[model samples]
Each structure stands twice: as structure tokens, then as C-alpha cells.
Target: MDLAMLLAVAGLAQTPAPAKLPLPVELPAVANATADPTCGNRPALAERATCVVSTQAGVEGVLQAYEAVFTPQGWLVADASGNVVIYMKRKPEGGCDAFQVLAFADGEMAAPAAPAYLAFATIPRDICQAADPNAAAPAQ
Candidate 1:
């Protein structure tokens, strides 16, 4: 084969690599999310400040507020839109009854002023279940 023809064939044989989709990024920490003084000196239940971790998907706020509540040990469940369905680790068999779900928002984290708690009675019992049986259940 001619040198020019060989070179052309070789070039054609080498395809460019496929472009990569960007990996999902983690939500950034909330700016200036400090403890609320009003919550201080109140009863335990009322004193806790919910920390909302906002992301592209949605807001995942954690109630039962302690500083750095989501650090080290916590559970984060994201929806298709990247919204986090936040759940703290269940406490023994009682499960996650003690926690609360805040509002959903579009951003990296919910604003400090976001609503902190949902009505306890309104929360579904299954949300506190230890395992996600629906995901594991056999398809009908």
C-alpha cells in the first residue's frame, strides 16, 4: 500500500474516545449555618436545630440538631433528581422516629431559616423501617 493510503487507513481505524458524562457532585456545606440561640436553653426536643444539606437533587435536612450532625454517622438517600431523602441511622428497634424531614429546595443546602420539623404523627411508619423492603421485595 502507498504511505499516504496506509496513513489514512490507520487514522480512520483509530476512533476518538467517547465523551464522559460528569460524575454526580456532592452538596456543598451551608454557609453561616450557626446554632440558633433561641433553640438554646429550651427543652431537649425544642432545642435541637435541624441541619439541612441542600444539593442539586433537593434538600435533605437533619433534625435532632447537634453540630456537624451529618458528619461521621448518618444516612443519605438521593432521588433521581439528586434530591436527598435524608435519614439518620435507626436507633435500635425504634428506628428513625426521633428524626424529622424538612422542606425540599433547589440548591446545595437549605437555608438556615428553613422549617425544621415535620409533624411526627404525619410521618409514615414504613419510613422508619430498618430495611427498604420495597427495593428488596420480589417484583410482582
Candidate 2:
């Protein structure tokens, strides 16, 4: 191979593979929404990683966009408390996993008209329930 072709091949070989996100789903294309690449790659069942979504759209718009992306992929709106929306999906192993999104507008934190933050956290337990016995409960 020529020097240029060899360099290109070396660069391709060095490129890192994309991390496997915990939810294994894609975010919706909201207007002016940009995601920080270092988030939502946690593979542990109990651990949660948050991907901040910087968007010019307001809080409502962010939530709507997430709902559109998550709903069709078998995720249901489990709860919406203030700026946070919890989406739950049933696991095939007789349990549930959840994606919790917390959206904040410009005025909520930092400067005015700042980027809206969409923090996503996934948990193995259903957030709709009052308690999760398997997680916090003492073993027999």
C-alpha cells in the first residue's frame, strides 16, 4: 500500500469503537440538541450514567422529543414529576428497567437561555413502584 493508504488504515485501526449505552437506544433529534459523548455508557445494572443534552429548545420540547424517541421502542411513561420524566420498560427476565430524564431550562440554572440539560439515568427496578425488594431488601 502507498504511504497515504497505510496512514489511513492505521488511523482507522486506532479509532475506538462506540461505547455500549446502558439503554441501547438513540436520542431524538430535537432542535439544536447536542449530546455530550461521554455519557450513558454504563453497563452495570445498578449504575447510571447521564448524557447532558444541550438544546436551544425549552424544557417541554426536550421532554416531548425524548417521549417520541422512547415510546415507540417499548418504553412507557411511568411518571412525570415536575421537570423529570421517568420512562419504564419491562425486561425479558421478569423485571423492569427505567430511563429517568431530568430536563432543566436556562433560568433554572446558570445563565439565561442556556442549553437545556437532559440527564438520563437507567435503573433495573421499576420507578413506578413504591419499593424494590430485590435491590435494597436484605437477603435471606
The candidate maximizing TM-score is: 2
Question: What value of lDDT does candidate 2 attain over all alpha carbons?
Answer: 0.52
User: What would the per-residue lDDT of candidate 1 be over residues 39-65, giving only the tens digit for each residue?
Assistant: 222233222332333222221223223
Candidate 1 local lDDT, residue 14: 37
Over the stretch 1-140, how does candidate 2's per-residue lDDT look in tens digits?
11121111122223443433476455656765566544223223113345555543354555666678777899887876555567777767755677666554333234335454555666544554434555555569
Best by lDDT: 2
lDDT of each: 0.30, 0.52
TM agreement with the true structure for every prediction = 0.26, 0.57
Task: Please identify model 2 stretches exceeding 4 Å from their true place.
Answer: 1-21, 37-48, 55-57, 105-112, 124-138
